[model samples]
Target: MVVGSDGFWRLLYPIHHAETIRQAAEKNNLDPLLIASIIRVESKFRAENVSKVGAVGLMQLMPETADWIAKESDIPYRGTVDLSDPETNIHMGSWYITSLIKQFKGNRAAAIAAYNAGPGRVSRWINEGVWDGTFETSEKIPVGETRHYIQRVFFSYEKYQQLYPNF
Candidate 1:
């Protein structure tokens, strides 16, 4: 029998490092599915992944951003080396997500967009009434990459929640 589409998708989107993801998510009071989705979108579960722009590790954290997160969150951070470690990356990423969520006043879309485009730009768009900080009107976002990033992260987040409810 052919697997249903949901089952097929689940097979494709298996969660990795689930316990680490769960721990980081719980520490930050975030949904584990969200952290898993971000890791999927950012690094495709590749712990050593690094973006062209130098975002390091599974969370694709920029070195400068990671440094700031470490300082603000009081997490042990030595250098870019720390970002390559899956556990440290997850901890820092989760902390950054929580910080962004609070900064964006609990708007997950805005927070996710900020994660991709930087909070300053996202804040400007929101303050200028260019975007309402919701996925439904994402077109108003000036940066195409960030708009798409928000959509991708949200889509992955939904899929993870469906495929791994107990995660």
Candidate 2:
């Protein structure tokens, strides 16, 4: 009841796009908290942010990936420029996460790793016996960025769950 400014900001940051995140998660059959965690890690809820590698919006979707998802899902894509729009970006990103989850057979950690490292690479690592695609073994993920990414997302997810149980 007595949350300070810092705590309030922390709570607000992850839930800034609550409506869009909830809608996207529901449509994609994903946990809204997971989406919020990803948004927190990817863009800190900044809809206009763009990564150095051209990832755009709150979900940080790359242009080519967005186009491919649009083609695969038959969703009308207005091009990467629209990725700056929170609703469009959240929907597309949520769809992508669902697709990745399916590809990895519901292995959330592997799917999340793929989201950062690419499915092909994750599959290769699994096939080659490099990493077992489990959270416990994520430390062995060869890609440092992806390994840290998975940890960060999971950490944020835990925080979200704690801070907003209803999320």
Candidate 3:
């Protein structure tokens, strides 16, 4: 799926839940495209998809993480099964991403890395200078999975902007 209008549509079709994504982005003070990119990369807008590691829904949030976010944000507690709901998942995931962006001091690459790996590991890497928390230095990230995840998300993010220039 490269090089044509078909590829563009394939890449962006997952963002059909634009209303939910925009609502979550507005509530969290985030760019809707960023949330869309994350959803595209994480679950491809497949609400029923679950990662082998147990992330769920359009945003691919883990149950434990969703629980913590609910408690911390004072959102009502729903069972993990609700993570398969696109609305709930997007809201939770947007809040989590907003928090990560703040935790990483607005370094989006580091926040994306944290989303793939974990905030604690990303923090340690930053604090210890193991990685500089920039896309240019992404190769310095030790975890191969996280490294590629960051790259893929950013690549899709750029495409989302290009395809939807007015978005």
Evaluated with TM-score, which candidate comes out highest?
A: 1
TM-score of 3: 0.92
Tens-digit per-residue lDDT, 1-167, candidate 2 = 35665477565555887888889889899999999999999998889999999899998999999999998885558998889988889999999999999999999999999999999999999999999999999999998999999999998898788788877
> 1-167 in candidate 3: lDDT tens per residue?
46577566655544668888889999999999999899888888789999898888888988999989998895555789889888888889999999999998899999999999999999999899999999999999999999999999998898788777656
Q: After superposition, how far is residue 90 of candidate 1 from its true place, in Å?
A: 0.5
List TM-scores for all candidates, in order.
0.95, 0.93, 0.92
Q: How high is the CA lDDT of each candidate model?
A: 0.90, 0.91, 0.88
User: How many clashes (backbone N, Cα, C below 3 Å) per candidate?
Assistant: 0, 0, 0
Off by over 4 Å in 3: 1-3, 6-13
The digit string of per-residue lDDT tens for model 1 on 56-130 reads: 999999999998997798788899998999999999999999999999999999999999999999999989999
Count clashing pairs, candidate 3: 0
Count steric clashes of candidate 2: 0
Worst 10 residues of 3 by lDDT: 6-15
**lDDT pick, better of 1 and 2:** 2
